[model samples]
Target: MFKDTNQEDYGSTRVEKDSIGEKKIAADSYYGINSIRARENFNISRENVHPELIRSIAVIKQAAAATNYELGLLEEGKKDAILEACSEIINSNVAEELKLDAFQGGAGTSTNMLVNEIAANRALEILGHKKGDYHIIHPNDDLNKGQSTNDVYPTALRIAVLKLLVPLTESVSKLQSALQAKEKEFSSIIKLGRTQLQDAVPITLGQEFSAYAEAVNRDRWRLYKITDRLKKINLGGTAVGTGLNTSHSYIFKIAKQLRNFSGLSLSHSENMIDITQNMDIFVEVSGLLKAAAVNLNKIASDLRLLASGPAGGIGEIRLPAVQAGSSIMPGKVNPVICEMINQLSIEVICCDQAITMAARDGQLELNAFGPLIASKILKSLEMMKNGIDKFVDKCIKGIEVNQDRCQQILDNSLAVITSLVPYIGYDQASILAREVRESDKTLRELIVEKNIFSKSELEEILKIENMTSPGRKK
Candidate 1:
């Protein structure tokens, strides 16, 4: 008979078996054991455990245990043990070896396994027992008791998003500050404003900066609102949106426990069926991410164009130089950071689309594709957060306005004709602007030659601020 050999190490054990001839096979002893099988089974690489999401799992576990304690579902001793174990895992400074592969099936089962192994081993130490001994707080029996992959995974995603949302909001606030600073610095400067990429009117640099600041603030509010909706936890909804095998007391208890642990003001979701089947929340969050991405992309595009050339392009703004642009191009300082932010925005937009598709692909009770949703959303959050930080620090903070360029563009724009409407008549101003455009001369020069108004009088009337708020300007 083939015999299984149980070998004991110092505080650790390995299960081995002699199959066929003399070949010995050993069972995996770490949290990533299932990951090996999952990798082979699915052979899919698109769904991997992101590090942020992995860290978030620990947060979710803590939140769950905390909720349990707060609601008295778990005794003080048990809660302390669980929390101690979780804390050990989170605080441990392990290298890259502990990280799980990003792509795994079963809706982030690999990450769950990783956390289980780490927490289980740490708990073993806490209990003065050998590691890999599932007896005192077994990974599946005690640690994951009353929890299912369905609810736990999604709850973890929400927690992770919440963690990221804090910093993202802060970054948005920083961006606003930078824009406001620029607004004040450039208040007296004016430039030709564009509509559909063509010169339309004249506006102060301050007003343009204020518009950007408002857009970022709007995005911040959108993200904040989306996160509020996400705070509703599905922890009580065990497998298949049913509290099957879960104690009725444990249901409410866990939510309360998690709320205390996370300090997130979390509540039990009103509808488990909707929570389980509808991934629209992810879509909603993703849409916010997309909007933020679009905003950043627009801002980045504007920066790049504004800093385009001292000789050929607008050259109306200068961005900070973090790295040399090209190896061969002399004095070429590229807007690499802004370009990186733009690329990240594109990636986030793509992730949003992937989230949309995954949400729509859900068939009945479960989305079956939550792994993808989780990965994409988490990725987008991380990218956005990092990109915003870098963009703010490396680009926005050091941005300098070219006042001379601004004045030149403003003086050359035919849009000043609008300011002449009250004095020269709209028909005359229109005729003058057309003549100026045809002759390739400055609008001021054209107005002078046409005897539309004296130079000093035109200067006083055609101040950029006066064009938009006609009555407010003195």
Candidate 2:
């Protein structure tokens, strides 16, 4: 119905008909009727489903085909054709053929159909048949035998997410190691610590960086452990978590084949209905992602504040200047890398919110929101991995502590009074602090003027090592 007389409009069009009607698709295109309808119906995201997701679905089809052939359901020639087609998809970079929007309705029905159609047509070509000649290797009858979209979509997403998490954990570990290196680098540089944004006490910059490193270490562990929860899949559940047309043997044997194909220790869901109906595991994973984002955001904000200025602001640490910050301000550089991390964290947090809400809004038997959840979760994982790597390379590794600035600020600030309070008493120290703040004199000048302690005694009390340690330096 959407076709024009000019066949060149669709680049040599072929008529592919579905129950809804028929439309003209590219003659040489692997995608068929369902894909054409989806392209016309859903152009929301305008971005293709991720390549990993497509490849993951191909693995599912390949494994399913092998299982079916073993069970005496699929013929040998059809199985071989499907295997070769799926293998080419996994190894080659022909993701363009599976052109469906990542974010769409029907709970990934269109995506499942797109994959089925592409695989079926590819298998047809392998068996010396033209596209749309699905009579030989039908999309649903052969390629999707004993499977449903509800089962296939979530299984593919789990596989893709598991593959995605490997690099994410590695990037987080690298970020933690980078922070640890900085912690050791700044271990001896004592700086003024702030509580509620006011001068409170003295602490080494190393201690602060240690806190960051420990936070990131926790994030790494959290991301690493969540794979177990994702390993359980409702693949054989069919329509409503009942085996439906699928045999019990097929239900049990598919997991082994899938594990072999994907190289993951995947297991079948104990309660397929629950796994299919309730999507809480994804929400749990998103919660951990939110935590990781929170940590990255906090660290990035602190780095930007610490690297505020070379002349004004805190100026305690210098970040690597990677670009010109402003057009009008001369010789100015901003914390672009840290800001990038902050922005990425914000987006990850937003993606998590969408995932949580979509998961919660699932209907009676199906979520109908798998597309949203999958896209957000996968995007969050990918961006976090990329952002953390960039942050480690451009910012954390290049950070240089301003030892002179730290010493100068501590020399003039009132935080050092905490160090002297033990010997001078809290009342005397409070009085000295108040007087120094009110008057123009520095803490050192006031202490020397009042003879609170002798000059040598004050110097000894205010030593960087002594001030930063506790309980009389052990």
Give per-model TM-scores: 0.86, 0.95
lDDT of 2 at 408: 87
lDDT of 2 by residue, 209-282 (tens): 99999999999999899999999998899897887998889988899899999999999998898888878888
lDDT of each: 0.74, 0.87
Model 1 ranges off by over 4 Å: 1-13, 16-29, 39-48, 59-80, 93-97, 422-426, 439-460, 472-474
Instruction: Please give the RMSD of candidate 2 to the true structure.
Output: 2.8
| TM-score of candidate 2 to 2 decimals | 0.95
Worst 10 residues of 2 by lDDT: 1-10
Q: For residue 460, what is the lDDT in candidate 2?
A: 77
Q: What is the TM-score of candidate 1?
A: 0.86
lDDT of 1 by residue, 233-336 (tens): 77778777787876667778777766765667877787876787778988998999899999999889988998998678899888998988889998889889
